[model samples]
Target: MGSLRLTFACGDYDRTRALHEGTVRPDGIELISLRLPVEETFFRMMRHHEFEVAELSLSSYVKSLDQDPSPFVALPVYPSRQFRHGGIFVNAAAGIEEPADLRGRVVGTPEWQLTAGVWIRGILADRHGVPVDSVEYRTGGQETPGRIEKAAVDLGEQIRIAPIPEDATLSEMLADGRIDALQSPRVPSTFRPGGGVRRLFADPVAAEKEYFTATGIFPIMHVVVVRRDVYERYPWVAQTLTKALHLAKREAMANLYDSSALRFSLPWLIPGLEEARALMGEDFWSYGLEANRNALATFLRYHHEQGLSRRQYAPEELFAPEATEAFVI
Candidate 1:
């Protein structure tokens, strides 16, 4: 039989590099790796099913589950995980000293359902008692002039959200103090020089660490997904792809912990690895269903609460049944 050929779309990251570079291979699949910006990947994959496999936005994937005959099915192998404390930026003069301060404010986002925005909102609402519905949300591109929502979002009746003016960007609104705060993965361009934009949590790293210690949820931002046609035709691909990605992550962790030399440009790389293990578990960037239950559950809960998903999806339901279970000796 010919090697099952497939297209794999994802971001270029150390964890996913092994598979992309051919150091590791999914069981029998011949992969055509498409390394693209995650945003582009998610947009194209979700809109047109442009790739057989893709790194999908966790928020989009959760929302997609509600579609009649959803186009793709996800694997527990998350390619991107981010802690969102640093994502919340505020106009220094907005008087938004704390999460609660955002209640009556206008907060802008690249998209309301972007995984980073979702996590930031979830954190603010759940931990800080800043209700999601309390604030007015503005959505648009960051620095670019125009943007469109890639996935359908249902922010529920209680929440208020609207698109920004067609000619304006969120960065402009943030810089000029038009928007009181912004939650996005990218730092608002206005944060430079004399611009008034600043992080809501002044020390984002410290805040993220505290949030992790308190919540045990290092938010997952993206996961691997296969087109429904591909999945149904090749059921083995689910487990095969999951194992390959897990092995790749294992390789990444091993290299990160290697103290011999800096495999990456950053200094204290090994110590950083050790510190992460100390804070999170030894498997800090774990994959698979059971390993990420709390984080997954927390995110889905936010997805439902934020009206992104019609149903409150459980972690087990997110992956193929075969991928969720494996025989052990």
Candidate 2:
């Protein structure tokens, strides 16, 4: 039989490189992986419908489904670390110590209705008793209103909405005191810039734990999806890919620093393997079927509640039936 082409997309080049480099089963399958920004991946998936499989943000997945629900099937892939979105970060000189202090302060975000931004706003409204409509929100021209509109239909009015310079980076904004606080994925010590800003309120990990504990929903940051027709044509391909991903996850988990398996998987993508090594950090990556399902279910419920979609469907609707047992949540 000729090789079956399988296309994949991911947000991080390093993570995509790691997946490409690792143990991809060559048994009648030819993996075609593309590393693209989050928006590009969604647009390509919607336009061409050519890829057999894709990795997408859970939020983006929901948004795409809202746009055109017939072309693809989505499955939970893994649970990412709980990212904090609604916390206030201020220069040490600003002296903003609490959520209430964020009032009248300029805040920066990649987008208005991004997962982190929405969740952060929810927390502010629910926990800190902040009215969702009151805070000032600024975006660096990265907000996709169509995407945000769909997400907001499901997530509600969580962001305050403002504008920021197109070229500003979160690190630069926080450093220069151009913005009082910014909502973003939790940054490691290495990613954190030197000096000035201090985390005031809201720990993303702690918030994740609390949200999950209270709601039995773990938000999905990313998911793997496949065309339903592809699965029908090659039933075994799904199983093979899942097994390979499982193996890759295991190998990644077992050794972040040194892994013979990864070194041999995709040498072309990881020229020096230095970026791969850095990403292997404990907090950097995660994968599994059950955890992914749990997060997806949570996101679906959020979507349903927000009215992004008219109905809530089971996670199985998005994945191969045989792989259903592997998804726990």
Best candidate, lDDT-wise? 1
lDDT of 2 at 132: 57
Indicate which candidate wins on TM-score: 1
Candidate 2 pairs with clashing backbones: 21-265, 21-266, 137-162, 153-306, 154-306, 290-328
Worst 10 residues of 1 by lDDT: 320-329
Q: Estimate each model's TM-score.
A: 0.97, 0.65
Error of 2 at 148 (Å): 10
Model 2 agreement with the true structure over 1-329: per-residue lDDT tens digits = 67877777766533344467645453577787776776677557656765778765565565556554455655435523454642445665666777777767777666554555556655666566655566676665322222223233333454456555545455566667777776665441212444677676547446555664665554456667777678777777665666566555656544544544464465554433454345333333445545455655655655454344567765655566655544342
Instruction: Please list the residue runs of candidate 2 whose C-alpha ends up more than 4 Å from where it truly belongs after superposition.
Output: 11-19, 35-50, 79-82, 85-88, 91-95, 103-106, 123-131, 141-179, 186-196, 202-219, 228-236, 257-294, 303-320, 326-329
Q: CA shift at 270, candidate 2, in angstroms?
A: 23
lDDT of 1 by residue, 180-276 (tens): 9999999877886455888888788899999989988888999899999999999999888888888888898888777788889999887777889
Backbone steric clashes in candidate 1, count = 0
Query: lDDT at 319 for candidate 2?
Result: 64
